[model samples]
Target: MATNAEIAGRFEEFADLLEADDVEYKPRAYRRAAEHVRGHPRPIADYVDDGDREAIEDIDGVGEAIADKIVEYVETGEIEELEELRAELPIDIADITRIEGVGPKTAGKLYRELGIETLDDLEEAAEAGEVQEVKGFGPKTEQNILENLEFAREVGQRQLLGEARPLADDVLAFLESVEAVERCEVAGSIRRWQETIGDVDVLVATEDGEAVIDAFRGWDSVDDEIESGPEKASVRVGEIRVDLRVVVPEEFGSALQYFTGSKDHNVSLRNYAIDRGMKLNEYGAFDVSNVEDEVAGQRVGERVAGETEAGMYEALGLEWIPPELRTDRGEIEAAANGELPDLLTREDVRGDLHSHTEWSDGNNTIEEMVDGAAAMGYDYYAVADHAEGPGIVGGMGLSDTEILEQVEQIREVDAASDIAVFAGIEANVDAEGEIDLSDEVIDALDVIVASTHSALDQDAETATDRLVRAIENPAIDVLGHPSGRLLNERSGLDFDATALGRAAAEHDTALEVNSNPRRLDLWGSAVQAAVEAGAPIAINTDAHQPSTLEYMRWGVHTARRGWAEADDVINTWELEKIREFLH
Candidate 1:
């Protein structure tokens, strides 16, 4: 059976191929349906398996034609149309489109003109100066393609946190159901919620390692078994590779700690343990203060801790560090000093500070979005649709007049709504850090989220200055996705996080950790810098549809990685407090 991500991924491919083939409106529909499909809480595959066509179509933004394709895909494990598109293009459409400025149409053009079918071919052409000779291709455009080709290759090598995390969840769900398994958890970058991960690492505790390993290897979701042993197994699930290591229940915690590592963090932790006359490893923590033979064996000293992860840290007289904070960025020292932050949890978030609807490129109505937020039990929500500005193609953003009109609609919705609905705009910060909105329009909005959607290639100093200028804007309540980075796609603006953080703090502007899987901007270290500077943070979904509102979970974990506490996040505040801050 296909996962939602897999099924949605198919639709996304379909959209790309359609666009590459120059089919216009259909590509948008397919893309919209893909977004909602990925966001839909229910398994679209289940409906198809049960022969429930009506239920499949019930998913928002899924129309009859697309739903039919989805059903065809779920039932047959392939969509005929998608296969036809793939055969027609016969190029790596997905990989080529990942180039920073390369779109589906551009990929199509490249293929038709230069016979470029892969990144290697494109790179070869660009290097030979052949790309610039092609129609519509300039030296700068060729340079961009060359610059981002490595990023595209890197993207193929790793998985986005959003894409990989769900697979981890499913793996855990299966592992937990095994009777022989005493405990199971994801480790590695996924555990720390890094924006991109190499693979999914799962640690299992069990007396019967063979049974657990067998169960893992035989799991239904396993697309291919790479290798398996009595104690461990590696399997492929779609594009994600999952590795499971089973250990004795007593050593589970230590094994988890050993595996859930940023190499630097583990190295520092091992040295820290050594300083305290303790030895830490995958087996357990042992007190070696009294041991005479320093290199006798692996367990030369008395075992002090191992049964539980908390005990492993507790034995060292430190607060058990949250996995997200295990980045070795002073976390061990902070733990020793009893200064580990009380990190924010999902429950601490009181409202969504950024979201969208049909007013822009969003797929839902304002009422529908507000209801979705209310359903999440939020005290408030902000409908900050994109405002017309740089890089906002297709006239998708709201014009000044349209923004006020939407404000009126938002006000009307707020009047009949159960929660406070704040009308806001995600205004684009231009090359020079100026917002596209007028002073009057800026003042009219309740909260202004200024972001950079263009000029992401600016040098560090220029980028930092641009962001600081935006932060200084009194009406700009939040600097959204301050760096504008897209995981595995583009490393956006190179800016000084500390400087940007301090500027935001001084201007009372909050920094946003965009929860969209592609853009967890202000990711970790950046957010940490902002929080350290006393600047507030907002974990927003940047949700374009109602179902995507659940992306807040990713955002919350991202904030934790940045060591943000509930108080550091503005959306965690009460309604009155947020209103006061906005004012």
Candidate 2:
């Protein structure tokens, strides 16, 4: 059966193809329906299988036409219209649109003009100076396409954290069910919570390595067994590669430390170990101060630490560093000096400032969103739906009148509910960094999250200026998704963080660490820079649906990676303190 993600993917592809074909209206409808389907709480396929087409159509933005397609996909495992459209265009629409400045319209234009159907074809055209000869194409545009081709290729090789993390969880669950498995952990970049992952790595502590390997190879999700050994195996699951390694229980800690490295961190540690007359490897740390033969193997000397990660670190005269801070970014020195930060955790988040409801592009209504927030134990919640401006799609942004009207509705809900509901707007910051909303509307609101929705390709200086102007606005309390980047998709902006952070500090505006897995903007390094510059950070999920609020964990880990403490994040403050800061 097709999952919500699979069905949503089809609708999104349908929208992309329609847009490329120059078909209007329906594309927006399909895209909106796709978003609704992806965020729907239940399995859409279940509705289709039960012959409940009405139930499926009842979904927000899903019409009879989209309902019929959903049914077709669920029952027949394919949508005929989408297949026909693919046949008509016969190009990699996804790959082509992924280029920085290229959209569906541009892809369609290039295909129609130069018969370009893939990245390879587009690259060939750009290299031959044929793109500039085409109408509306110029030297600068051609250069951008060429420059971004490599990034696009790299993007194709990696999967978004949101998509890959669930698969990792499933793999871990399956491995843990094996009788021979005593301990299991996910390692590498996934463990570090990097926004994009190349593959899933699993390490196991078990005496029966062969039994563990056998059990892993027989799992139902294994699409193909790439390679298998007595102690190790690799399998392809869906579009991701999963590797499993097993060692004896004693060596589990050392093995995990060895595998969960950022290469640079491990290199520094190895040198540190050599300086201490010790050898470190996956097996254990060995004291070799008196050993005459250097190449006598790791087990040739007295064992110091191997049973636990902390023990290994203690053996080296350092504290155990958090996984997120294990990036060789002074974490070693900090650990040695006992000065590693007490990184922020999920519990530190008090409320979410950026969210939406049916009044804008969200699936739920105001009452439902408020109820969800109350259930999450938040003291306050802000409904910062999109305001009328650029990139406000599906006519979903609220006008000044609508925002005023929403303020009344929000007050009514706040009076009736246990949790405080703050009326707010996610006002769009234009290319000039000026908000389109009136000062009156901005001041009347409890919070204003200014974000850049369009003009993402501006050069560094212009982008910095635009953002600094937004920060300087007295009405703007937080800068949402400062860089506007989408993981593995778009490099939204490239401004100097130190400059922007300093300006933000001067203006008393908080920088947002958007928790939406796709846009963990103000990523780790940027968060650190902003915090170092004395600018407060706000970790917001930018949730369009209630369930997405759970993504706060990802944002917290990302912030921790940046070395942010609870006090450095404004959201972690009490409701009164938050309101005081806003005022």
Candidate 3:
């Protein structure tokens, strides 16, 4: 059955569509309730069944009217108001507006004016040059629509992080190999681990900016040149757009600082620089109309962004800000108070907590997984592929009998291997929050990672309650990817993290920071919140193949955003301590 969380999530999507369509206030109300319901601790249907709609009334922005609608939807499997709204619009609003620049209002307008209800219709109209005749849309806007429609049709969506990170590494390696380039770093959303990336931004510092630009355009992956300039160059590599920005060696630090931005962070920093009678840009900050009259914005003077990132901070009379903490979260305030938690580093990670093998869907076997971990210098590794249940598509997970048999093989590997091997299972959490594996089997494993694999459409209350129950289970060692979101592919589940984090802490269950670039689960803010609630984190690669084990760098970056320290992570502990944690 569709749980309360699932229903609420659908409503939330409808609400976003309504907002895009510039629907009435009720759409916003539904969205607000969806957010609140998704975050509520109790199962929403409890209140609905009890004839007390007030169950979620206390949810911020969810008043009596919205709660009653939720109750009505739960009982009858239909929300009257939503049905009415759909009757009026009755369009696949999300599909039409998913194009880069198209919003809900535009989608609605397009639908109403020209009956354009799908990407196909929009593309046909754009190609026919009929869209330029729309009320407010000009030829330029029509051109943009045509361009984006073609791009969207060809590329579908931004490349997944799993696919993009290795490409980033390859480019970085190539840039480093260039003798003229002094330093280089990835900047923008890819660095931020945003669910989707529009383009890949790379900032390079070189003695010869022109030579670096030429080299970038000549990159082996470059299939076509989009633009070539002294400081910046854009190229099309297959379908992905790679943008390279080159700066002089003297200005490298400033360029890095300017480029490695959360836009808002850079804006705030630039304002701070302006206040200090300086101008900050790709070129180093300069004293413009300064009291001391040093490096003016117009006339470049001396480099001040280097010496250390801290020096950049010293110039602004602020403490150094870590790249991950630059999200305009509490970093500025935390830096001011000198209260930032020392974030975890790759060195602090002693082992990988989650891996897979040929026994399940993984390409590598236990021995191969162990050797891969050992090569990466990990002291211990866990082989926790799918355990019999929902997530094991095509009936691939290990059955209870098979799991017991696998335990012996795992023991054999552990006994023979130099590094400690943890026998574990990635058990599925059913819609009701119950794990598929028996307690006897769960207890036998060194680690039990309970994950949600099916019925992803549950309401927030049901999803949260389901998860809360799973976390409370003593047999379940960690709640893997608490949100169950799969980047651009899927939004796994919606639940109250505050409640889940509390339950996890109460049960002493770790929350996984899944290191798979495609699924950096328990993302930055959630990790921070979980850490604050005293829930230890497990940075697991969930590696299906040997090559994937190295994706931990992106996972570490994700954790650092939460200001997670080595002490806050379970994998940072020694094998003995990790065993104690499991027990």
Best by lDDT: 1
- lDDT by residue for model 2 over 429-500, one digit each (tens)? 999999988767876799999999889887656788899999998889999998787876776876767777
Q: Which runs of model 3 end up more than 4 angstroms from their true locations?
A: 1-149, 193-195, 270-309
Q: Across residues 480-574, which tens digit of lDDT does each residue of candidate 1 receive?
A: 98879887677677666788888888889998999998999877877887888998898899999888999998999988998999999999999
The per-model lDDT (C-alpha) reads 0.86, 0.86, 0.77
Once fitted onto the true fold, the runs of candidate 2 whose alpha carbons sit more than 4 angstroms away are: 1-155
Q: Model 1 misses residue 174 by how many Å?
A: 0.9
List the candidates' TM-scores in order. Answer: 0.74, 0.74, 0.76
Residue 110 shift from truth in candidate 3, angstroms: 12
Q: How far is 87's C-alpha from truth in model 1 (Å)?
A: 39
Lowest lDDT sum, 10 consecutive residues, model 3, at 290-299
**Model 1 reaches what TM-score against the true structure?**
0.74
Q: In model 1, state the lDDT of residue 271.
A: 91
| Model 2 clashes, total count | 0
Q: Which of the predicted structures, 1 or 3, would earn the higher lDDT when compared with the native?
A: 1
